[model samples]
Target: MEHSSVHHPEMPHIPSTLTLASRTPTVGSARKSETRHILVIYVGGTLGMKPNSENSLAPVAGYLTTEMRRMRELNPPSDDFAQQGSSSSSNSFSSAALSNEMRVPTFDVIEYAQLLDSSDMDQQDWLVIARDIERYYYLYDGFLIAHGTDTMHYTATALSFLLHNLAKPVILTGAMVPLMEPYNDARRNLVVGMMFAASTEICEVCIFCNDVLLRGNRSVKVRHTLSAFSSPNYPALSVMEAQPFRPRRHLLARPPTGPLAIHSDMSGRVMTVLCHPDFDAESVKTMIQGTSKEAESRLDCVVLELMGVGNTTSTMARTLQSVVNTASRVGCLVAITTQDLYGSLTAASVSRLKKSCPDAIFVGDMTTEAAAVKAMYLFGKKLTAAEVKEWMPRNIRGEVTTVASRL
Candidate 1:
């Protein structure tokens, strides 16, 4: 990785040795003798992209490590001020100046490869990321993933399910603009994400963008602007932008009760169906068939993005019902998620589905991405349909704020 002085220049130098060995991909000196180390996993995102001579954004050959260094420099710790403030007994002026220095937490960079548009992300990519989380789950106090905005929600949801019983923060963040722009949003979002992951006591995976911290599975890309992710039905786990970066704390989910279990055996046989205005039975059949055919043998689950209140017209409903039946008969688990960004399925939809597919599990109010990953997670657990049917609706790490009584 090449070094640059463009991001932050006011701080002390980071040892190149650490930069080379650590995945954080930073340019900061070794740790401050006492602060605990925070490892940053740069998996590629808008944060490492910059405009080329042609004026289109492209991945800078070595932006990940450079940005990590800049993030540390821009937010150097406050220990110096503590010494300064205490050294002067009655000198209120010096003490005040010292107090003014921000308490910047130091983070180590672990630069991983895969830094690209989040859209390029797929099942293999997700498995690679999950394996990284497992490989480093014990080494670092927390993890920060810089991803592209396009499919951050899916990754977040996937990680939420893949990483079960997490005891530390796993914050996913990205920007509307590339890191190299003069006034790029990546700097603040990335910096704040590091801070959130380091300080939060929450054990669940989360998505942090703009000033909001959303539950990983609940989050969705609601816009193209810098403030792209949101979970309207659920309150933010925390918010950034406050001085000293105090997370709402209250919104953060409770810490896990057990040790982290990184679920590497996730079943990639999951599929998704969107409930569009023009409902077609053939389309539903084709989608399920295509996914199963493409899998050649792996397909084990499917998720339907039902319309408002989880509704599907009788025609489309029958189609989905048939698809669910087919998938179920083949030992595939079929699940339902509402198209509405914030609500759970209605009793009507649940009842209709129950009569048609009797044994299919519903994802309650969770987002589509969450439903997909959760389905994979359950399938991989090798739980019997009866077992998954019972556990899938429960609030596991706050994935779903509510559960349906009907199905």
Candidate 2:
């Protein structure tokens, strides 16, 4: 695999034989002397896109890494200054001065052969990424993935499950505007992502976009703004700021006890259904029934993105209940999530629907993307329908908020 590193004349010379080490320091000790090595997988996104002949932004091969190399932020400082960088004070360096210093981080970029518009990403693409991380898990301190904004949350949620017991940061970030654009958010997003990846403070999959470090599964895309993503149900793990970089230690995932395990088995058999005012029962029934016996046999789970707080109109309610009941009878998992970005599918919130579809799994406050990816992960494990139902509500990979049931 070919990779590139940015070099500068003013920066201290990096040794060819220099070893990469984790930024994690021993407890009760000062920072580690070695520089952290981060692997940035540029999988094609707005961050690396340029205008096509049609004037629409599109992924260009090798554009992202080239653009990143042109920026001063991606490169590290000279080896001499980096080796001298043991400061007792975290606030000693000004953000402006730090930007030009050699203390930032050292990283390599692996651009994908085929750049994908995030909308084009699917299970196969996710599998490829998961396998690559697993293949190189031991070689790097942390990893950053540059992906398209359209489906970044889905990819992040998939990776959160795929990379089990993650002990290093796997940050997914992209820009709302193309990197080549005169006014774009790409540079800042990429810089912050690199800094976070090189740190030992976070050890789970996350999305850092528009300065917010959000839990991967908790994030949702906000299409209309420069801050393209937000974590509505949870507090940000950290905020990317200028000058002093202080991560919120309390919000980070607990340290993992075992070596990282990768679970690449994802079943595309899971389906997601949206319940709107115009939803029809027969259409849903057909989806549940499948076109034929063979297809129905392969179906394992369904994620229902229901109306606010898991409610539906009386007509829609009956349709959902009937379909859910049929799905239950067929030993297929049925999970419920609310469309409301800020609320959850608590017992009180879905009381009406629960009365008729008692067996449905309630995924409170999990984003639709998380619900879909989690369902796919669970189904891929070939767990029984009962096990899927039980695990769906559990806080696996921090996908959902567990609350005490009022019932």
Candidate 3:
């Protein structure tokens, strides 16, 4: 994908009227500054979109940053605004309140040259974002990814695996409505994302939208409501409350001990097959059984979105087992996750299916998105079949609620 870098010179400056918390004395009576810098990576999404020639909301290059500059919430604190206070006698109080507002961090936006609708995103797009984060990992205190809502969960899950041993906050957010609209969620999402990124509390890749901060790998876009995403199995890490700009913290991932490591070489040879009432065994066989020897060699894994609690019709069960057997015989890993969004793949639930397919690896309560991306990540590392099987069941990045079981 083509891309360009444009620097925004006007950094947000704190107002002089606001009294900051006393800083620790530094060398020779100087005080350490509290300001934080964040790198905002603007990968094309609905948040930055504007009306195109046909008047449909579409991503417009350079438009997002321009609009960001106009928002007073994002802009630097201005003394001029403090001077021209509110009309009532409470002007001083209002000015004082404004002065005491949450300190917005200075950030730079790197817009992709060819903005993409989330639907257009693929493994290569995931690679591009991963590479960008790896390249600028150390330069900024934290990172914010503005992505399209359609595939944001997938990208978030991919990034969680790609940016291994991540030590800083990498918050992903996007808007259902464009930022240019009068009433939109973009501003709040971006603002909350910025606040979280600047803090030292969260160190994992997370998605912040509709007031909830969730683990990137665990979150899924649930509906078309303003609260577009939710972590079905996992609890949210934090909640954004605007009254005093306080974000209530919940469970958080431990900080990494080693330096950040990025794994960009993702193998896209993994296939996800969904089980249904009208499932076709021949098609499943065709997918797992590659047409050519070369194609078969390239195929590494299959993530089957099995029926509730990892079950299927008795007729389809035998066929599915045979397909899994075939896939395993040819060095491809077969991992099974449930189609239901909220249940674990318990041994009791899948006992019948397990009897037919003892080799199938059951991923317990792991989101299909995480299962797919984790398979790709493991395959990209060129792990042996045994190693892949061994690691798939383990909670590498908190993807699975319970240890995966292999019958």
lDDT-superior candidate, 1 or 2: 2
Better of 1 and 2 by TM-score: 2
Q: Distance (Å) between predicted and true CA of 25, model 1?
A: 15
Candidate 2 weakest ten by summed lDDT = 14-23
Global lDDT of each candidate: 0.65, 0.73, 0.74
Superposing every Cα of model 1 onto the true structure, what RMSD results? 6.4
Which candidate has the top score in TM-score?
A: 3
Regions of candidate 3 where Cα sits further than 4 Å from its true position: 5-32, 78-102, 242-250, 295-298, 309-313, 403-407
Question: Residues 196-303, candidate 3, lDDT per residue (tens digit)?
Answer: 887677677899998888999998889997899989999888775546554334467666677777644777488888988667767776767787777545478888
Residue pairs with colliding backbones in model 2 are 12-78, 77-102, 95-243
lDDT string for model 1 (1-407, tens) is 22222223423343221222332223354443333346676666778787779987866645767656555443433444234335544433223332221223456565543355678877666666666667556656677887888888888887877776777788898888777778978887877687667663657788888888888888888899987988967888766543544556677666655676665467546777776867665765555555544444646667777774334456666666777777666566677787777677667868877776676777677777777777667767776666666767777757777632211
TM-scores vs. true structure, each candidate: 0.79, 0.84, 0.84
